[model samples]
Target: MALSVREQIADNSRIDILSAAARCFMDRGYAAASIDEVARSLGATKGRIYHHFPSKADLFAAVFRHGMDLNYEAVRPFIDLPGSALPRWRRMAMSHVLLMIDTKPFQRAVWIGVEMHLRGATTPEQRSVFNELIEYRHNYGMLFRNTLLQGREEGVFRFDDLSITNQLMFMTLNSPIFWYTPRVGETRSDVEGVAKKVVEYALGGLSKRREEGV
Candidate 1:
């Protein structure tokens, strides 16, 4: 269902707070991030943040959810496309990598949120929210996993371990967030070109060789 007008405004304000908070977390560690800092980054006051989120952890959780939602929305279109699973999977992977490059702040927040979880920085309440986001991330991962399984069934891809291979594929796709920077003259097409090349490299590892004629 569509959001009502008031709900839409509230969501927009919430996203504004989340973006500011994400930048704060991205610049400093999440544990070091403070609501005051996020407010300053947004040129707003702490009350503005508190108006939306009750705590820093809640704001962080919102950022994590926002980042995950962006990923899901970006690649969700290609997940169920008809035709060979390999091609559909490639498009999804490419779209994901492109989003990681384009949406650096939110994607970085995602990595930082994972780091926070690993370091035991979250309270029980925050952990609850994080766990829910984790489930969403798992659902997103399952789309690729299912596609990989289908490709394997068709003899289009070769992998020894399904679970490990799925994780490896995502790791490879997510790695660009660590080192990628947009060039001075680069366009979205240029970024997609690079993303496509990266996807091809990863897919090539799993695909059967044309010469083998599977």
Candidate 2:
């Protein structure tokens, strides 16, 4: 259904707030991030953010959730595709790599949120929100875990331990965020080419057949 004008405006503001907040967290660590900083970045007042979120933790949580949603949006279609899981997994990997590059700030916020959780830097309330995100992340991981199991059953991929292999796959796929930056004149094709290389490298580490032929 189409959004009404009021709802559209509200949604737009929410997205703008999330984008600005993501950058705020990226520019300053979460411990140092504030709604005022986010509002200043948006050239608005803290009241503008409070209209949508009650606290900095909630705003940060919303940003993290939005980032996860972007990843799901990027790869869910490929996950639902018919036929072999192995090939679909490659597409999923490529889709995720592209998202990491395209949405680096949001993705970086994701990593920062994880760090906050690990350091126990968040309050009880923040921890509550982070826990929900943790569950959401687990659910997302399960999607890929199912695909890996399918590929293994079909003898399409080889791995000794499912959990270790899954973690390794993600470390490789998510590593681009640590080092990638868009070239001065980069195009969609250029990004895709980089994503393709990352996926191929990931596959090569996990399965010989993928690098050799698939």
For residues 1-214, could you state the per-residue lDDT of candidate 1 as single tens digits? 9999999998888888888887788888777899999998888889999998888877888888889999999988998899888789888998899988877788899988777777877788677888787788788888787889889999889999988888788888888888888889998788888888789878987887888785
Residue-level lDDT for 38 in candidate 1: 90
lDDT of residue 96 for candidate 1: 94
lDDT of 1 at 80: 83
Q: If candidate 1 were superposed on the true structure by all CA atoms, what would the RMSD be?
A: 2.1
| Stretches of model 1 off by over 4 angstroms after superposition | 1-7, 209-214
The residue-by-residue lDDT of candidate 2 on 1-214, one tens digit each, is 9999999999999999999999898889787999999999999999999999998888989999999999999888887888888889988998899899888888899999888788888888677788889788768877898788888788777888988998888888998888998899999898899889899888876775634664
Candidate topping lDDT: 2
Instruction: List candidate 2 segments past 4 Å from native.
Output: 209-214
Candidate 1 whole-model C-alpha lDDT, 0 to 1? 0.85
Residue 49 miss distance in model 2 (angstroms): 1.2
